[model samples]
Target: MTAAAALIEAARALDALGFMPSKSGNLSVRTGRGYLITPAALPYAETTAADLVEVDLGGAVLAGHRRPSSEWRMHAAIYAARPEAGAVVHTHSPCATALACARQGLPPFHYMIAVGGGGDIRCSGYATFGTEALAEACVAALEGRRAALLANHGAVAIGRTLAGARTLAMEVENLARQYLALRAAGLAPVLLDEAELAAVFEQFDGYGRLG
Candidate 1:
């Protein structure tokens, strides 16, 4: 599928999953000149490929009638910083956003935490949304990681493909939900240590490779 179509498909799926409540999220795919991102203020269920906006790394709109997502700067910053990231998925999924609202990061409570490329998912320091400061904070928190929680905001995940990013975003929510449940039960969940996580990383080297 085309990047724009894939983006819309992911957005709608996330929307149905209630991740993009009240239209509070964005998705993007890197292009030759820059990236194509969801347009601002549009409901995912009603969004179309034609509504996707193409903007350069410098944030110039190359094509599209509508304005780009307000968080486009964040997406642009990520692409400029992480060359390997082909797509970005940002969401306000409840459980994760709840943790973000508390300014909490997800510790390595589950082995799956390693899916983010680290022992834990850091929460970026608080910042006003759609600003460069927010982008910078997110980039810093995502150092050596594929996902992060935006303090008092939401969460973001990046990957080499749109499907990969979308899946990681969902995983973030699932992890957050489980972590919160553990906390609610007054259970101090056992966290995976660096050594254990290292083993996980090694095992994950070709985890899904069939060939």
Candidate 2:
């Protein structure tokens, strides 16, 4: 699929999965020079490929009819910091958002935690959404990871493609549910240690990822 078409489909898929409520998330893909991102405040169900906006690293809107996502700063800063991040997904996914509201980071309680390029998914310090400060906090928290939770906000995931990013976002929400389940059962999570996690990472590297 074309980049614009793929992006639009990804957004709608996330929305169908209930990650987005009242248009509370955004998706973007790197465009060599800048990036193509979802428009701000538009319901994903109502968005079309033509609605996606392209923006520069310097915050200029290069193309599209609707305004770029307010969190374009987060997308631009992440692209600037990690050249390998070809796509980014941000969502107010329910389970993940609940954890983020509590300022909780996802630790290595499960092997899937390593899927995010780290032993844990850090929760960034709270900041108002859409501002440079929020972007700075996100960049800092995601320094060595592919995903993070924005405190009192939601979750973010980056990957080499939009599908991969979307999958990572889904995994984050799944893990969040697992974590909450453990806590609800009055059981403390027994996290995998660094050595074990490193081995898992090696295994992942050796196996070609499907998504």
Candidate 3:
């Protein structure tokens, strides 16, 4: 399917999964000289391909009638920083958001944490949403990683495609849920060592069908 179609599908899927509740999250895809992103404040159930907005990496609107997602700056910054990134998915997934609210970054407690492109998932320092400050913070947090929690905000996942980004978003939430459960049980999860994570990252690089 086309990137636009995939973007819409991702929005619907994440919404159905209760990740973008109340329209609090956003999705975007890199396009010609710019990117197409979901409209601000639009419910995914009611959104269509035509409703997506296009903006240059500099945050200027390039096409479409609707305004881009409030977090467009964050998406734009990511694309500018990571050439391999083709899509970005930001969601207020419950468990992930809860972890972010506590300003907690995910440690490499599970080997699967390597899926996020690093030994751990980082959390950005607190910054108000929709501002360039938040974008800057997110970019720093996402350095050498594909996913991060927005402090007191939500989570951001980047990938080579919308599907990949969506998958990482869900993975982040899943890890968060598991981590939270451990913490609730008064367990400080034992993290995997760096050598193991290095091995996992090498495995991941060659393990995927699409890779």
TM-score of each: 0.97, 0.97, 0.96
Worst 10 residues of 3 by lDDT: 202-211
Model 1 worst lDDT run, 10 consecutive residues: 202-211
Whole-model Cα lDDT of every candidate shown, in order: 0.93, 0.94, 0.91
lDDT (10s digit) by residue, model 2, range 120-211? 99999999999999999999999999999999999999999998999999999999999999999999999899899988888888784423
Poorly placed runs, candidate 1 (over 4 Å): 208-211
Off by over 4 Å in 3: 209-211
Pull out the clashing pairs in model 3: none
Error of 3 at 131 (Å): 0.2
Error at 103, model 1, angstroms: 0.6
Per candidate, the number of residue pairs that clash is 0, 0, 0
Clashes of 3: 0
Model with the higher lDDT, candidate 2 or 3: 2
